[model samples]
Structures are given as structure tokens and as C-alpha cells.
Target: MASPRDPSKRTPEIESWMNGADKLERLLDRDKFKAWGFVIYRCTYRSDSEWEEFIVRIHKRVEEYLGYYNGLDLVGSFAPTVLEDRSFEGATVISLREKFNEWAVTAIKEEQGIDPSHLWHLKNGRYRFFIMVDQEALDSVLSTPEDDIHEGFVRLVNAEWKPEELDEEELAERGGPGPEEEPLEGCTEEDVGWMKVCWGHSQMPGYLQLDGSFDWDMYYSRPPVIQSLS
Candidate 1:
């Protein structure tokens, strides 16, 4: 029998490729004025260390490319191998889905002051994690220390310390806004409002039609080239 793969040993290149595809999906959604396809990057990491490094690197790169993005979020899970289990794997797709759902519920509660009993729908081999963050909530969260934000999240879920600690480090590594940083420019207030509306509507199942099925081939296929925004 083949040895189980160690998700931590996966190269950063693979994670980068997956996240690049996610960014493409988001860009396409914005370009087409669509209400769907807001691109949530998902991956399985072998260890907490690997996951921490991956999150930090992605956040730094994203900040360099786009001053600051309130929409960006991450969730991960860590599972250890059991003794005498030769076929044990560190993480599974199901565990990741659970972690994401946990995060989504907490986020929704914190932002909306209401428990999210029906916040996610997992079907068609994909999990949907949804949250509503209007401008006010976004500004408030961004102003606070990233660690505090993460701690509040952990308190909401009553989860163990492992994932909570990982999330804290990930948020800290993202750093705070730079001195020269300014809110998103170019887009008018009306545009921002529209984007929020689109995001909200898209979270409802069947409300928006995604162009293609959520299959590996469809997701990893070459994306069309677009003119550079830079």
C-alpha cells in the first residue's frame, strides 16, 4: 500500500498556485459584475508550522499587491497521527470544512450580533463559509489588534487552543496598516455598496449561477489573460 501523503511536505508553490487561481476567480467576478465567484482559497497543510508560514506569506504578498483587503480571511485545521496507525494522514478535507464552518459562524456572530444557525451550506463536494461585514464592521475590526480579533473568534466558538493559537500568529504576521495606507480609492461609494450587495446575494444558494462546476479540472484550468491592472 502507498504511504499516506504528508500535507505539510507540500511545496509552497502548490499553495501559491491554488491561491492564484482563487485571486483570478475574484478578479473575474469583479470584472464581469457578477454576484458570485468571490474566490475562497482552500488548502490542506501538514503541520501547524507549515500552515502558519503559508498564511504569513500569503498575507504579505497580498498586502503588497493590494494595500489592505478586509475581505481576506483564512481557516485551517491540524490533526496528528495516531500511534500504530501506519496509514494515518495528518489532515482531511472534511476536517478543513469543519474548521472553516466554525470560523464562519464566529465571524457572523461577531459582526451581526446574531448567531448564524444557517450560515453555511456544504454540498456538491464543496463547503460554503459566509459572513456579512459592512463598512462599519470592517473598519472596527481593522482598527483593533489582529490578535484581539482572533481571540474574540476563539471565544465565540469555544474551540480548543491549537487552531486558536495558529490563527493568532497568522493575524499578527499580517501586520497593521502602513502609514501611507489609505482606504480603497478609485471605487466610488456607490461601487462599494454594490460590491457588498453582490457579495451578500451570492452567498444564498442558487441565487447566483457560477459559470462552471466546482471540479478540480474546471478550477485548475488555465484562466484567460487580462490586461494588467498595474
Candidate 2:
């Protein structure tokens, strides 16, 4: 896989934030990313309900965004305490986190579905959340001009809420296999005879473990952007 974009290669604006020496120093000292690749944020919450509300609001926001760019994977969760040192390399991790937190808090407050009464101490620990883009998918997204990318993100965030409506016929069509049934051609008496011989001497386990390594280089890489929708 391509190494993360070198901080030096970033635009002046991005470079300035990426190379914030003090912030990097502090983050490194904290040993964030020690586990599951995460960084620590000392969040102070007003109450438990507020924390839960924040999560629900962000979940909806992320879902909307993911729908726009089907290729990207934007999953998030709340951790009891922030993980150590999990910021994106060559980027302003803290600033990005703060921006997301601000947006989420504001959205939660404005949306009636979110209840602030459950807000609790982020003081118990910081919550760690993340949004990651597959490099290949990101490359495709970035091929568009920077301005358009920003606009896309905005549209995702401000998307109007709509109730999901299902068409009964369509739903039934997707529900399962058709009413007609067919016999398995490969399971004839001859095939069963060969199978018995093959398995006569040994038993095979039902499952096998898969190694996790995968080829990420095949995908494209692109810079992240935020867009606004009119």
C-alpha cells in the first residue's frame, strides 16, 4: 500500500496543520494508537443521555454520508476512553476530532430525537470514534475537484430526513428463493459414491481460519475533503 501522503507533500494549508510540532509531540507522548489504532481525547460530558444522543445523531449523519459515496466505509463507535495515538498520519488529528465533535453536539441539540438528559461524564473517560476511507475508493472520490468533494460532504451532513418506504411486491421479490424448487444435480448416486471414498479415511473440519492480510495497493489513494450542498 502507498505510504500515507508525506506531510511535506500536502498543500500549505494542510501542511501547516499536519506539521503542528507541539500537537504531534503531545500526541506521541500520550502513546495513543497503542491499541486498535486510537488516540486519546479528554471529553467532558454534561450527562449520560447527552453521550448516547451524540452517538445516535452521528450514526444517522454517517449513514447519510455513506449512502452518497457508496464506495467509502464510514463506521464509528463510542469508547469508554480514547485510545492512545490513533490519529491519521500526516494530518491534524486533534483538530479533526474537535470539528466532528462540535458538529455532532450541535446536531444532537437541534434534533428532537436526541435526548440530552442522558448526558454523562465524558470525564469517566474520553470516547474514541473514527471515520476511515478505503484508499482505492478515496482515490476515485478525489478525482473530482476539491470544491466538489467539499460540497458532497455538506450534502451528506445536511440531507433531509425521510422515512423508509417499502414496496410490498419488491420486498417479497427480495425476501427469498422463488417458489419453484430444483433438485441438486451434483448430488447424484455416482457423486455420493465418490464423496464416500474421498471422506472414508479422514474427517474434515467444518470451518477454516483465514489469514487477515489483504492487498490494499490495488485501490487508489486520494486526499480527504468536505463539501457543502445547496
**Which candidate has the top score in TM-score?**
1
lDDT by residue (93-123, candidate 2, tens digit) is: 3344555455445433453233333322111
Provide the global lDDT of candidate 2 against the true structure: 0.26
**Regions of candidate 1 where Cα sits further than 4 Å from its true position:** 1-52, 68-89, 111-230
Clashing pairs in 1: 7-46, 8-46
Q: Using Cα atoms with residue i matched to residue i, what is each candidate's TM-score against the true structure?
A: 0.25, 0.19
Residues 88-135, candidate 1: write the lDDT tens digits: 233232343455556556644553344466333222111242222223
Model 2 misplacement above 4 A: 1-42, 72-230
As a TM-score, model 1 comes out at 0.25
Separately for all candidates shown, the number of backbone clashes (residues 3 or more apart, or on different chains) is 2, 24
Error of 2 at 190 (Å): 80
lDDT of each: 0.28, 0.26
- The most accurate candidate by lDDT is 1
